[model samples]
Target: MFKIMIVEDDPKIREIVLENITKWGFDGLGVEDFSEVFNTFIKYEPHLILMDINLPSFDGFYWCNKIREVSKVPIIFVSSRNTNMDIIMAVNMGGDDFIQKPFSLEVLMAKMNAILRRTYSYTSVESNIIEHNGAALNLKDSTIIYNEHKLELTKNEFKIIYLLMKNNGGVVSRDKIMRSLWEDESFVDDNTLTVNINRLRKKLADIGLDNFIQTKKGQGYIIL
Candidate 1:
């Protein structure tokens, strides 16, 4: 079942939303600690987030930006604010959709279902997670996690990691990596591949996982 996280401050509203989500055959996780919402978010790893604008320690905008840095998990702002600027800001800050306050539960469910369908229906694969050496990469969204530090990666970077991790403990040649990337999508030359590998290595190092990916000299790269 898909996991949905509700981050509303109002207890009554939060409960009501969760109840509806449960009734609809989804697993719903309600936020218990407002001050540590990010920690809770990392723990739950919900497929979708229902965020409120007026949070306790930090507003939804702040949390949205934070989450965007690490994830592309679909976030829909559930706020009382209906101003044009609020909606625009929410979208700009990585929120997938926004619902105004006092909305009917039915309407909310409809929107949620629409977003869920639109998000997952296009994919042929059911599972998108790839894990190696305590690092997990979400192929669907290009998000990576290691030792609780999350990072969003570019398309080429994601492909590179996916290839290496899939062949963990095995060497993947540079030419093979280039062939895996789309030729028409972008012109990935030898230098471009090296740049992506270096950037990925730096990102991994920032998360306390230095040298996670190893070089095999002329052979290629490996994650041993």
Candidate 2:
């Protein structure tokens, strides 16, 4: 089932939204810890989000930007502020839709359905993901997910991981990695590939995935 995360602080509004979500046969994850919306988001991995413009600690715009850094999950802004500027900001922050306050649940559901359909309808099964030992590389966002922990990666870092994960059980040579990242490696610095690999390994380590990308001395790297 698709999960919908609600980031509104008001208890009444949160309950109402969740009720409607349940009625529509979708799971609703209400955020209680506003101080760590991103943490809660990582835990839920919601397919869609209902975010309020006004939030504790940080505003929805800030959280929206953070989420966009790693995910393309659909976000719909629900706020009382209906000014043109607010709506524009919502769009700019990667919100799929903006629903004015005091909206009927029907309207909210309609918007959610429309956005969900549009976002997921044309999704092809040619998976844009590569996985090894529970570490998943999202090709579309250039991020990694390991044990529910996510890390956004740089372009070179992503290419490195992609090459390793694509050849999961086999040791990919450093030369092959450089070639995959840049068509021509002669112009690249000798240590650039090592630097990128080290960075990617550190990121993987941060998410409880230590030694995920195993080094084979002079053989290159492998995700065993």
Best by lDDT: 2
The residue-level lDDT of candidate 1 at 222 comes to 91
Please give me the total number of clashing residue pairs in predicted model 1: 0
Candidate 2 per-residue lDDT, tens place, 81-174, comes to 9999999999998998999998999899998999888877888324456667666677888888765577889888888888877886899999
lDDT of each: 0.84, 0.85
Instruction: Give Cα distance to truth, residue 131, candidate 2, Å.
Output: 10
Instruction: Flag regions of model 1 displaced more than 4 Å.
Output: 124-224
Which ten-residue region of model 1 has the weakest summed lDDT? 124-133
Error of 1 at 34 (Å): 2.4
Q: TM-score of predicted model 1?
A: 0.61
